[model samples]
Target chain A: MRVLGIDPGLTRCGLGVVDGRPGRAGMVAVGVIRTPSDRDTGERLLYLEDNLTTWVRRFEPDVVAIERVFADVNVASVMTTAHATAIALLVAAKAGVPVAFHTPTEVKAAVTGDGRAGKAQVTQMVTSILKLTEQPRPADAADALALAICHTWRGGTEIRYAAAAARAGGPR
Target chain B: MRVLGIDPGLTRCGLGVVDGRPGRAGMVAVGVIRTPSDRDTGERLLYLEDNLTTWVRRFEPDVVAIERVFADVNVASVMTTAHATAIALLVAAKAGVPVAFHTPTEVKAAVTGDGRAGKAQVTQMVTSILKLTEQPRPADAADALALAICHTWRGGTEIRYAAAAARAGGPR
Candidate 1:
């Protein structure tokens, strides 16, 4: 299965694609879609939307996994993050890509065997999982890859297979 | 100038379109866009996006005004509201229409001369301002009209005009 994992943000949205199945996934691509912070909110959102659509078209992933943004006291930051996450969800739907969301804790637990795993530990696990010679550049990029790894081990293939069956003739 | 005001919500998004400026604005249309709460989040968002886009295309508003959602204790609710608001903003940007946001307090102050005006008061003031014989149907719809009135008085036309000139040759 090919999976695209998204770490949503306005200024820098991380995207990573992994190929293969559970316990044998390999990194296909890892990067971020960035927008200038100085841009208007609407314009920035449009940019992100455009790029996400482009990425989905280019990758043709079987499934899309996104890190869900939680409500928090830092309302301003959370709002922006929520907006970006919304864009991601909207993009996936438009592209006819079935998408699922994993919480930060869920992702950490799946990737590093600890719900409270630190960033370094998570990144290290991601590197080991993908057997990459070096860590994915930038923390966000590594985090995106980790999300892909987590999804694979945590039922992404089953979800995609189920979605495919639904599309074919089974109950949704 | 024509203005479309949006009060964003996942289940009940309020939309109002008005004609004319500041002291002379009148309602052209007002209604609520609702989606079943039981629908999946992506489907609900898609419904709001489709309705908002349809409204803008039909009305061809000169500007779009949306309530600026703030961070609150209800994180889940706020995030959903923010997502709907993002869809509104993105639709306006895509249509090449300038968009403005009025805070709840700002909308109340502009409509009723009191920032802390209650919903009924704001609705009453909106009815008075729009010279409507009766209050706009639902409270959400009334709040949307109030946002339109606030935008008209608060220089939506001036902002649009300035944006036009900037696109023509003036500084942005």
Candidate 2:
């Protein structure tokens, strides 16, 4: 299965693509989507949507993995984040691709053998797992890879009714 | 002064534009940015960035207003929410527009004279204040307008430290 992983952020988002077969694993693409700081928030979000839509169409990965929201404060912030996630989910559904969501702890545990792994640890493991010559830049990119890896290890185990889930939910 | 308010989200973002003048009340232009629900979190963000950039170019507002995040216990959800706000901030910074943030409560208070105003109350006030012929569609758009109104009122009292704050924060 070809899997795409995403580390979500407003300013920076890390994305990684891996081709996983029954016993063979390979890397496809890994990079970050950055929103310039001087644009309007609405424009930034549209940027994310535009770039991601293009990426999905170009890569056509079988599945997409995303990190789950981990906290509850900043109600305004939460709403925005949810919007971001909702956009991602919407894209995947549009492409007829399945999506898997993993918690930060689960991604850390899978990537670094600890649920509490630090950013550095997660980055290190992601680089090593992909056998890259250098560590991924901006940390978020590697984290995206880790989320993808976690999904590869646990794909299709969790069933999601995304469209139904979204309709019922108020916030993004 | 022209203040642009944004209610950032993954699926739909609320955008409100208010024209502020010395010794005169402002007016509002409110709308929502809607993205398909099938996109993944990353692509959704990219969409947000692109559209928001377009909005800025078209409107050329003097200032931007955004809601601060409200935290929650669901870590997976919180991360996505944070990303949305972060991306929005990045867009404002890139555009060289001054940005201000407000809490939901603060926005409610400014719009409805009650910090605990319901969504309907806030929406009604937004319509009345803007002298709109109809209620803004999709609550996000109205909320974005309210944030803009709040920021206009609050930002007026704020020391205009655009250069210093920009340099200190850089582009998000």
Candidate 3:
């Protein structure tokens, strides 16, 4: 299965694509979409939508995984982050790709075996897991990759569990 | 000038359109766009976009005015409101209509001359100002009309001030 991960932000939205499922995966692409702060919020949102639509069409992933934004974060940035997230969700839905949201802690736990793992540790593990020659620059990019990896692994388990449940004739 | 005002919400998005300027205005349209709560967020957002796009096209407003969402308000609903607000902003930008945000206080003050005026008072004032025979149904619709009226009156002052500044050979 192919998955596209997004770390949503108005200024620097990170995008990462990965292929495979369960224990093994390969990175297909990683990058960020930047919008100028000087532009009006509407224009910036439009730019984000354009870029995200492009990414969705170009990659044609089976699923889109996004890092969920919490309301408890810095008040000033949370609203903008939420706006960016809405765009990501809209794009994925418009493209007919299912979406999954992973919190920062959930992503860290899935990749580093610790819910409170530091950024460096998460990056290290992502690099090792994907067998990349170098760490993904910009913490947002790494975070996006981690989200994809987390979804891939977790989603595999979910599918298997459902299959097993079907074999048993019903859900518990 | 015509103005389209939106009171953004996921479940009940209020829409109001007004014509004229400042002290004299007429309500051209007032309604709400309802989405099923059982639907997923992405699908709801897409439904909102579609409805909002139709509003912009049919009304051909000079500007789009939206109620600004604050982070401190009911955390559970704030994120969804922000998402709806983003879709409004995006639609305005795509349609090439200037967008303006008016705080709740600003709208209240513009309509009733009291920033902290209660909802009932604002609704009464809107009904009177638009010379309507009865109150606009649903508090959301009333609030939206208030926003458009606020922008019309305030935006008029802003435009006149800018013109005055130009007449004086530059901004002070």
Candidate 4:
């Protein structure tokens, strides 16, 4: 399965696409969409929407995985992050692609085997797992790749279990 | 001037439209767009987008006024509210309508001359100002109308000031 992972932010939104399932994955693309601080919020959001729509149309990923925003994180940025996330979710839904959210800890644990892993460690693991020649430039880019990897490994199991439940006439 | 006020929320998004300038205003439309809690977040947001797009098209307001979201309010709901707010902003921008944000205190003060006025007082003032025979039902609906009224009264001054600045070759 191919997954598009997003680390949503108004100033800089990181996007990474990976093709894989379970234990193996390969990076398809990694980049960031940046909006100028000088622009009004509405314009910036419009820019994000346009770029995200382009991403979805270009890659045609099977699923979109986004990093979940929590209210407790940096009160000032949380609202903006949530706003950007909403745009991403809307784009994915409009494209009819399934979307999943992975918490920071879940993503770290999935890639590094430790929920408390440091940034460098997570980046290092992502590079090794994807067999990349170099580390993803910005921390946001690495985080997004980690999210895709996590969803591929973890979400794969969940999808299988859901399918099994459906076969047995159980709750989905 | 015609103004569309949106009190953004995932479950019950309140929308109000008013036509008039500073002191005098008439209610053109007032209602809420609701989404079921059972629907997934993406689907619900899509529903909001559809309804809000319809509102913008049908009303053709000169300005779209939305309630500003703060991170401090009801931690569980703030993120969702911010998400909804983003969709409103996106819709306004896409339609080329100018967007403005008003804090709760600002709306209250504009309507009731008290920034900390209670909801009932604000609702009563809205009902009186529009010369409506009946108070707008649902606190959300009343709050939305109050926002529209506030924008009609307050935003007018800002718009005039901006125009004056432009005429004077001053910064806008």
DockQ per candidate = 0.64, 0.17, 0.88, 0.81
In candidate 1, stretches whose alpha carbon ends up further than 4 angstroms from where it belongs are A156-172, B156-172
Query: TM-scores for chain A, candidates in order?
Result: 0.89, 0.83, 0.97, 0.95
Per-prediction TM-score to the true structure, in the order listed: 0.90, 0.59, 0.98, 0.95
Candidate 1: clashing pairs of residues = none
10 residues in a row with least lDDT, candidate 3 chain A: A67-76
| Best of the two (1, 2) by TM-score | 1
* Selected candidate, larger lDDT, 2 vs 3: 3
Model 4 DockQ vs. reference: 0.81
Order the candidates by DockQ, highest first: 3, 4, 1, 2
What does candidate 1's lDDT look like per residue over A16-59, in tens digits? 99887767889999999888788788889999999999999999
RMSD of each: 4.3, 8.6, 1.3, 1.9
Deviation from truth (RMSD, Å), model 4: 1.9
Angstrom error at residue A163, model 3: 0.9
| Ten contiguous residues with the weakest lDDT in model 4 chain B | B67-76
Cα error, candidate 3, residue A112 (Å): 0.4
Which tens-of-lDDT digit does each residue in B1-172 have in candidate 4?
9999999999899999999888999999999999878987888999999999999999999999999878877986998999999999999989999988899999999999999999999999999999999999788999999999999999889889999999999999
Where does model 3 exceed 4 Å of error? none
What would the TM-score be for candidate 4 when compared with the true structure? 0.95
Runs in model 4 deviating more than 4 A are A162-172, B162-172
